[model samples]
Target: MNSKKLKILLSLFTLNSLSLYLYFSSHPDHRRLPSRSYSVSEYSPPHHPLSVKPWPILPSYLPWSQNSEPPFRSCEAYFGNGFTRRVDPLKPNAESHRKISPSAGGGGWFRCFYSETLRSSICEGGRIRMVPERIEMSRGGEKLESVIGREEDDELPNFRDGAFEIEVGDRSRVGKKLVDEEFLDKYLEEGTIDRHTMRGLIGSIRSVDATEFVCSEWIEEPTLLVTRFEYANLFHTVTDWYSTYVASRVTGLPIRPHVVFVDGHCQTPLEETWTALFSSLTYAKNFSSPVCFRHAILVPLGYETPLFKGLSETIDCYGASAQELWQKPDNKKTARLSEFGEMIRAAFGFPVDRHHIPKPASGHNILFVRREDYLAHPRHGGKVQTRLSNEPEVFDSIKSWASNHPNCKLNVVNGLFAHMPMKEQIRAIQDAAVIVGAHGAGLTHIVSATPKTVILEIISIEYRRPHFELIARWKGLEYHAIHLRGSYADPPVVIDKLSAILRNLGC
Candidate 1:
């Protein structure tokens, strides 16, 4: 019972502890659990690892040197009349092709072509460039005097009506001496001739010639030129993103094209949700420093671009039409809308190829997209128009209903998208079995929802638009609409509609 016995006991205890440590180290799975344990939430799914492929990097060489490269051709030879094949004008889906011949001295020429099926226009080849600020047209290495040369008089082209200079004394002018009034006006006009129109005009009028421009960087791969809307609304932004995807598919690009935003207007930078869809993103102004691409495709905005037209009577559904272009007969994997959604999810490191998965055993998430007042941009006053006057009441009703549901687990998620990160918003949408929201831009997240997810849009009579319905149709998701007689939807009515929808899903 003295020092000798204590030493013997300590030796036995130390040997046992060392043996256990060594055993646990060799087989770590046998380690004892910590006092605190974490539980997986029924509604919060695990995030998928980032699986985006690296973007392709093309070689950049000195201007004239790259002309010998595979895709690079002399401007004169490329835009020659004989270079392009003539299509029958009478054909149903005939493409409209306009050829601009080189001026007398031989500077640069371009061909503006429009596809009827895609409803998009693209111009190729030219020497003289007519940008918004500068208008330079060269013929035989000589700068042209006028847009159309006349033998009698040699004077610069006049653009008095279209162009205006900002007066120095004008109060609107903070410090700038000169401002392009034409560009400013066009930019301010929301639906009219915007930066996209100007880009198209410049691309058509401008010429890429061997005589004047030595391509600084000759991009060999086909590039997608996207002109985004100045205001970054989710609905319009989705259209632009979809157009880029469709352009890549139609053009037969082996891989997704590197997206280049051609518009100089910088109202907002690309949102994080959309940035991942592109292999790479760049600005057209980035190329004005004098870069040339072997092939550049300008994707049209939204419905005009291709694939799907929103609420257009002439063509209600173009998703199927676009599917024909890329979906191979043997390939059972990709559907047009589903593939686009997957691409976005993959970019954000979300689970892909889950379109056909069964509902979770734990529960079904009912995501209620809550619209809140926040300044979307600098011009915004942080006051959003009320689509649902009783949004809070409606949300509370849904939450209460979910908590009381008897048949199956129903988890209610308040999707405050504006306050959450884009990836988190996407995760919420992916987790949801049903998404409910008033007729608002927030409902645009339906484009990213899982295939099995259902959409319940409560449209006030004042806001009875087919925006979400059309999107649901295109995405092949089940859609339900509660046409309210006024701005306020009765919570009881909304709950009833939701109950019916859930009952149909066997919930």
Candidate 2:
């Protein structure tokens, strides 16, 4: 029966082929028509299985299933200390991001799916634990030139070692400085880098890449990086410190700049916590993005500074200092961190979340704050006092030359100090030949000063904040002591100390 059916089909095919060939031959004039070769196209289409599998539609009855998509997103559930559902990163699912365990410095169970420009944070799961019981002790006896070589430029003697200057096994073993200080639980003590130190360090660097490239394996440096960056944090945000830097290209300053907080600060916008978070002194290190810019960091924790240099922006008027009169006493009372972040953003003309990493340029000055410095100068003394009261006296205690020294020149233009950008304030302070200040937030700005900058650390003759002296020495600054008779609130804090320090610098 099969052979008979095959013979019938063959007979039919033969008749059809003969008829078609005859018809084509009869129409030979069609050769003038374009060659009718079928233009072949190849593609992949969804494959349907010949057989069906059992359906678990019963899951639809789940209480959470009411809003589940028809074709639910695929998640790979990998259970470890906790369940980590690896959502497809390409789809922007919350589960696809990197998981940051409290062990790795997360507040609780927060996960940052991507490793972006992590310029700010030092250690994650930041608890104010006793300082590390052990650290590769600094071979303090070895001079800077002896350890890393004195010649920082090209043509160094140890060029053959490798691109990195640190010699093999050079991290001479040293005992970690045991942490002896204690603080209340209210301070976000878990994270590293005291806010005071960070302010100085962050203020020291003059520019943050509005954009930066995200990197995971570039472990020798920031979690993210871009050429010529300043004041970048984990949120992939930047602060252009030099007034000339942003305006060197664009004519004016920006009203809104892209930003992110890399430190272990809680990520919350002022709008989200208008009543609760802001009302209470939660922590100085919190972060948030309101408007003008959304974050590409995708999540709050994923946001970092020094973003990839794939984008660009006109620095324009955004580089100028804010004219909202924040230095005034009443203004200081309203100076919220979110607002501070907002003021600089607008001054630099960048969306709080919009960053374009710029292509690197030559002859750029680079400023780096050692990890040692970052851990010392916290804004709050592990107390809820990080938020300072804006008062004339508070400003008076700092006794900064910002108002007195209208025209100072460190590099190029004169009168630079008078019109510097928010980021430039630290740089200008650093450029000063002599530095002076009582024990307060303004001292944090001193970390940016050029080496050889003399420091006049004013503290009580009876009481002392030892970190200042240690930091001054570690940073290679010329250290001087000013022993005051009382707390920093006293008049001698400024009147007696400021003038002497300034005269020494030839101010």
Candidate 3:
């Protein structure tokens, strides 16, 4: 009894399953799902839509477009491997319209298309209107009127005082009209300009005769005397050089043409380095010869880039005309030379502007800069001048760190910079990824280093300055500084701290 019922149920289930399958097969979504797939080679081009106009690429060559180069190759390259072929605009039944109106179908069409070199939208050729007016025609007026559907009655109205007669006239005069009494009176009444003036007790003339082209009295360009009167520090000297911008601003010159009259007292040997630094500004050949001036501006050390508070106050002593450039809200703190930096880079061509120059085949290098030659601190004593008491220990730590990282190479560079040429210095800095040194003027070499390079400054508690910090920030380098406690000749080194920083920076 159970076997017979089970067979009947199975037969009903099979028929129901067959009916459901047939229904789904005929559904529109289901039919579209497994639509015929074709390879790029097998696919055929469809007809162009009525909206787009066909621009044929024919044998008779003509300057069809403003640009001479075709963009098909670029477009094909932009679409990587397995991209569908471009739809032909000239083909009567091209499938270009499928990509034209994204709203109509799938919307991810590469929208740029060029015909003969003229870029045009796939959907843009429909009912384009420029203007609705009667354009002028040089040919027969009657023919143009007929084409424009305008009758003789529709001609523009010609206005006249008496008879409807007016002729197109030619020019009667070449120059400006004569300024007679009436014209002069009209202008005088309007207060536009006052050409007539009384000289002392003499009365104003009615109308003065105009003269031929003549030169007016020349107004002298403002001159600035930038004596080497600034502080003798290297940072101060660099900062003072940038302060020349203030002189430029006061003179109203475009960075050039201003004379940097460096008096011998505070002058450094500007022959090599100063020339490159001040290349954007003009410098006087010799400061010994003084030029006579009816009116001249004197700029002092503390005027623009004052290291201390007393500098700006000194500029005020020169009377009301002297203004401090750094004090202004527009001028950033200190003498930040964005314009000068660009000029220097362009002139000397330091700081190579490459994103990825390969590392030297010798090793992954980290520079340990030596400051034994030049002392950045203003302290006079030789004992105070020498920083990093345990140089050998610090050097060994760096070497040990390098040894741990087999690829890294530690290079100790000190008096080498003073000896090497500027180009060689640039080359050395450009290749190094990380620079380590005591807080000193030697760290300024980071300026020539490639961007994104790391700067590790070993600082002394007694002498802390943001000179190199500011320079590092200006040069777009990663700066990390660690302070050591001591006032001795060489500051004590924290070996563990140094090791951690080196490891964190990937040595």
Number of the predicted model whose lDDT against the real structure is largest: 1
Write one digit per residue (lDDT tens) for candidate 1, span 458-499: 988889888888777766688999998888999999889989
Candidate 1 has its poorest 10 consecutive residues by lDDT at: 57-66
RMSD of 2: 29.3
State the TM-score for model 1.
0.62
- Per-residue alpha-carbon lDDT of model 3 for 1-507, expressed as tens digits? 599657645654554455446534322121222124333233212212112111111111111111223233221111111011223111111232323321121101111121221111111011101111111111111222133432322232111111100011112211222123453232222121121110100111111111111111111222343434233344555555544433333222322323334222212233244455432222332212212211123342322232222222221111000012213411122122233333334445554234446655665556777654532122223233656767656766666655666435545443245445555555666667677777766566565555446787888776687767656654445778877776332323444554555565455
How would you order the candidates by TM-score, starting with the best?
1, 3, 2
Task: Mark the regions of model 2 whose C-alpha exceeds 4 Å error after superposition.
Answer: 1-421, 460-463, 488-507
lDDT of 2 by residue, 42-157 (tens): 11121121221111111001111012121211110000000112222111212212322111111111111211122122111101111111111121212223333222111111
Q: How close to the true structure is residue 272 of candidate 2, measured as C-alpha lDDT?
A: 25
Candidate lDDT (C-alpha), each: 0.51, 0.25, 0.35
Could you estimate the TM-score for every candidate? Answer: 0.62, 0.25, 0.41
Question: In model 3, which residue pairs have backbone atoms overlapping below 3 Å?
Answer: 46-93, 46-94, 47-93, 47-94, 48-93, 48-94, 389-490, 389-491
Give the TM-score (vs. native) of candidate 2: 0.25
When superposed on Cα atoms, how far off is each prediction in RMSD? 22.3, 29.3, 31.5
Error of 2 at 81 (Å): 32
Candidate scoring better on TM-score of 1 and 3:
1
